[model samples]
Target: MSPSPSSRFRQQLIVAPAVLGLALVAACSNSSSSTGGGGGGSATLAGDCAEYQPYAGHSGTTVTMFASILSPESDSLQQSWAKFSSCTGIKISYEGSNDFESQLPVRVNGGQAPDLAIIPQPGLLAQMVKTGQVKKPDATTVANENKWSPVWKTYGSVDGVFYAAPMSANMKSLVWYSPSAFKKAGYQVPTTWADLMKLSDTIAKSGTNGSKPWCGGIGSGTATGWPATDWLEEVVLGGQGGDVYDQWVSHKIKFSDPQITGAMQTVANWMQNPAWVNGGFGDVKSIATTTFQDAGGPILTGKCWMLQQASFYEAQWPKGTKVGPDGDVYAFHLPAVNPAIPNPVEGGGEFVTAFSDRPEVRAVQDYLSTAAWADSRIKVPNATGWVSANQGVDKSLYTDPIDQLSAAELTDPTATFRFDASDMMPAAVGSGQEWKSLTAWFAEGQSIQQTARDIDSAWPQ
Candidate 1:
């Protein structure tokens, strides 16, 4: 699947202030009244970064940022930054690298840090805080964070201090399917895990031209096994409950712990069985070679019944693919595992941090955390994929129905939200061994116990 809409990146551009002002007026006219940080008020419009506009005289100033955003996401961000620059006169020099997690420390340790950085993994953010290279967020930024659920503050906090502000959020509890095919087969959407399995079994027994019940892939270049890790994390959220999942992510419990191993087993039961997955790719091992971006392709061709992925997967569909409840392709929440457990959401987003305490940089940081920035970001033509967890962002601002639905899911008070657990682990384990072991489990035929043991061994002291 495409990376979460909240992935961070940097770019530098300037827009005509007058044009931006007009855009802001138009957006404001179309905006909803859900003041994000401020109390109940109209949503912010582009160039409506009311609190930070005082820094407009800082036009010559530039804030450098480092992040993992690139390509299409970079294009969207640049479009958003142009307006911010025009409104505040502070330029942004953004740089996105795939190796951001590995390279950020080198830059900081070498005393070559940027003015700010958009960090995607809190574990890496914590590591930077330990080195004293990161600074605490300003009060205004803190207030913006507080406007959202306490979860945003918790994600950006370390040692009881909030240092980063939430930038973007993606929903991860979706199961993508072909609505037309389901209708043709007279199947209803499943509401619980048991129902989902029963539906899978029914699909398999129906002999729909010998197609598998599911399609999956874990390949992502060096990030190959990350998707499988997501599956296990989601299972843990429902199968074992959030508190235990939290302990596992903090490494308070070993990877070989029954709670974790059982989750992994749950994933294997679907992924390892030929009747359940790799519908178009032939066998389970093919999942290792099939790119995640193309993994859900079989759903359109009716070769696979479902593909569990995040809301961001909407962008990967071929052009003209319908994505609403009645569209050619659509998504539903992966059903709850237990009635007693509140619905759990597994997702990720970027966090904003600063290396410089200069007024201009601080102003830019404050603006980004507010509803104004979200409005400006969404107004950009290339940002159709964007979604904000900020309570202030209006549903009307989202052009895509899927984005709106995802945003609703993120802001749902009844749902439990947790960041991707692998991202919260030490880099050596989260991005390294977890990726390797999960890949080996499915592709190399490693036993579940051995896979769990291998990951546990890779954990740091």
Candidate 2:
């Protein structure tokens, strides 16, 4: 089984920034803690600060950040830097708003942009760069980023200038199910798409006591259909591979193109198949109405057996619900569709982009890009549901079982990651028509061809 996604990470990856918050809660606390403040001299800090010497001496400087992450996750983010923040005496103030994407441009154009913002989409970051308001990363920050994979550097860059540091990442190609339920039903985890479908059929026919083999929800307030977009993106990515996936997102091929529509047809067969879905909920239309937050809950009561969601869905399970191979709920990778497709993992992440090039701000950005910070952030006390694309993160630091699972798959050398397509698409489509049209696919029984046409028409010509 695979690990988890933090909708919190997803919100940063997307909410609308969410469909990705479709991402989820982070991991739980269970790691070593030590203190060393002020040049490795005090016992008041959270972790080692030696690598941070060059960034120190900014006492009383406050670097401000703005993003879509809220509450506990936001709080954990603050703590992730507690040691660095303390060592440097640089206060990092944060502002989290549900309306960040809309308000950020307003903030930028008004000369009130944050020192840096955790931009969720490259598309949005590209817009910020176009305004000439967002600053390129400083040398130290860029140097730190150089240590990560070139793919991450590309996401943070526009054209070619590196602007943001890839932050928290979430894997969406995951299927959540109850371990005990599978054990009770005498089943094994499916590794290929054919077997996955077969397992669904096997469970559906074995008598679910009126429940089904799978359950799903596309609901997320205004982001209602974004979850469904994940369904199509994964099909395109896992079944078709990267070149085709890139062409689809860039509009080199239309959504109406068979390559794109073909994926949607796959979604229809799986999710829209009446017998396979709305497992714990009502009929097909209910998916459009059921909140993604509640989609995986039925797995606990044995009302449903499987839910396809990002790793972050771990945060949605009821408290006291154990989440391990031996626990009540656990997730496995969504599984490979074609043996020809090198492990394709569909995922998303936030980027640390700046409007201010102040030394303090860049210091923070540089820290986030470093392996030290990557490990630090994950070790934040009680933090849950987060994965960093940084290859530097120590797999062993992730003691939690789910974190171990997600980190393992994310770091798989053979896995090719395709960022969430809708999140990167032009907002008019990714967050607009594509969303509306996909919702219609479920709610109004819109045909895949028509749905594809509706979304294609919304593409900016």
Model 2 RMSD in angstroms: 6.7
**Pairs that clash in candidate 1:** 10-94, 59-89
lDDT value, residue 381 of candidate 1: 73
- Per-model root-mean-square deviation over C-alphas: 6.5, 6.7
Model 1: residues with Cα > 4 Å off, grouped in runs: 1-52, 207-210
**TM-score, every prediction:** 0.86, 0.86
Q: Write the per-residue lDDT of candidate 1 for residues 393-429, one digit (tens) a residue.
A: 7768897777877888888878877888887887778
Query: Which stretches of model 2 miss by more than 4 angstroms?
Result: 1-51
Candidate 2 C-alpha lDDT tens digits along 1-461: 01111123223332211111111112211122322232242222223445566675455567788887765466667777766665556667777765565678889989899897887777677878889988888777777776667887887888888889888788788898888888877899998999998998888788547788889988765556778888888888889899988988899988988888887888888898888878778889999998877888888878789998887677677767888897898888886666689888988788888888777777778887788888987887667677787777787788767777787777677887877887777767876788799999999998888998898898877
